[model samples]
Target: MGHVPTRLLSHPCATRSPPMKERKAIESWLTDMDGVLVHEGEPVPGAPEFVNRMKESGKPFLILTNNSIYTPRDLQARLYRMGFDVDENSIWTAALATAQFLADQRPGGTAYVIGEAGLTTAMHAAGYILTEFEPDYVVLGETRTYSFEAITKAIRLISAGSRFICTNPDATGPSNEGLLPAAGSVAAMISQATGVKPYFVGKPNPMMMRSALNAIGAHSETTAMIGDRMDTDVLCGLEAGLETILVLTGISSRLESETYPYRPSRIINSVADLIDEI
Candidate 1:
């Protein structure tokens, strides 16, 4: 299992590599983590095999997540416990994308961040100073505890000329008890108070996909994006010029997908349907 599938390679005699036209249309993959692979702390049916097949195909791939509360290593451990085998380097988060974006825009910048270790650590690695005194940006990300004081501070900082930036535009996040106010909901409040709109840096914004492509050294033309939602995942993949494959294991239903102005390249029942293609 650790080696590339034998069929992919050409044997000197009887067995030959697939002809150019017979080769997989997709050369690389970028897939959403939550709905496509797991749901409610459980691995989706055939999700683990799909991931393993992608790895065995000897293709470049990365697992993407909008949740910024956990770092790549943390998520890797979480997924490992849940039965998925993936390296930490194969994981990508909104926090990492946001940090990459900020680093490109202003290298050695300062920010007043309100989030957990994921966001703060990414900022630090990008050489961004986490401060409240005339910072360059007011960065916001997912957090288990969103204090009023932090929101108030972010509001004040944005009011005084700091640019507003959010990890993703999700208004609410899922929880065991119920829906919890996420970064987007708090961003709405801060925007209402200060009249400053935030620049979102996650799915539904193609920049994040582009960054992921660059991170994996893949080209959009040959890369395929596997996601479950038509709104964010599929839409972003479309905008990023990659082939989008939407699965029905999560949010968007086949009936719901018809309503979107743009459509995914293909829609399938689950990742199980895609294992052979990889």
Candidate 2:
């Protein structure tokens, strides 16, 4: 969240340097916190070192994620508790992105959200009205408990031509036990019930980039999207016109990379490798 640019001189033998040529010009980075930075509430391998490097360099970066269950404050505390010191404003969730989009598109419209209070609060704060009475849109995300009443209400609203807005399309996230169902699971069911596709506002969608750039004052040429998932993170950056780096840590393995639809600008073993490269 902090935006402080400090000067650093590259070695004389370095491949490139300022004034002579652009040294990649990576001014801002957008990264996923979970899986990439931490796994099971613990900092992932080399995460601490990578973050420390950023701090030392005074580089501007933000942690972005599709998980909408927690607020910025919640994530900030959790990361601090796990020994990763990050500013709360550096975290951007799908919920916040979706809410911001909705506010700009249809301010004060009613939303039938299928997520947690974090999402609801964001929507309301953004001038969106939360209601089950003939909602203007159906906002979908992960829900721990999908009650019969909730399904019925959403289906009823969907049948009435309420626009569907999905947070992210992730089907699962890693856990200590195993992979658990993610926000996209609920989005899939709702799409099936209403026979309507949703306007996704998470990864692979350019709106995420729009919001992230607005927050950090970065442009496509000067920003890098570093992530583990090619389908979402890498694709989002490519589609949004930003440089992308794929890391082999988290959800994507080497086998998965070969089958990815698009290729990343660069590939690294982890965020730590990014520190070495950039």
Per residue, candidate 1 scores C-alpha lDDT tens digits across 1-278 of 58865665655444755553332478999999999999989999999999899889889999999999999999999999888999999999999999999999999999999999999999999999999999999999999999999999999999999999999999999989989999899899999999999999999999999999999999998999999999899999999999999999999999999998999888999999988988
**Full-model lDDT for every candidate:** 0.93, 0.81
RMSD of each: 11.4, 10.4
**Most lDDT-accurate candidate:** 1
User: How far out, in Å, is residue 256 in model 1?
Assistant: 0.4
Candidate 2 global lDDT: 0.81
Considering only N, C-alpha and C atoms within 3 Å, which residue pairs clash in candidate 1?
none
TM-scores for all candidates: the values are 0.91, 0.86
Cα lDDT, model 2, residue 36: 85
Looking at model 2, residue 180 earns an lDDT score of 83
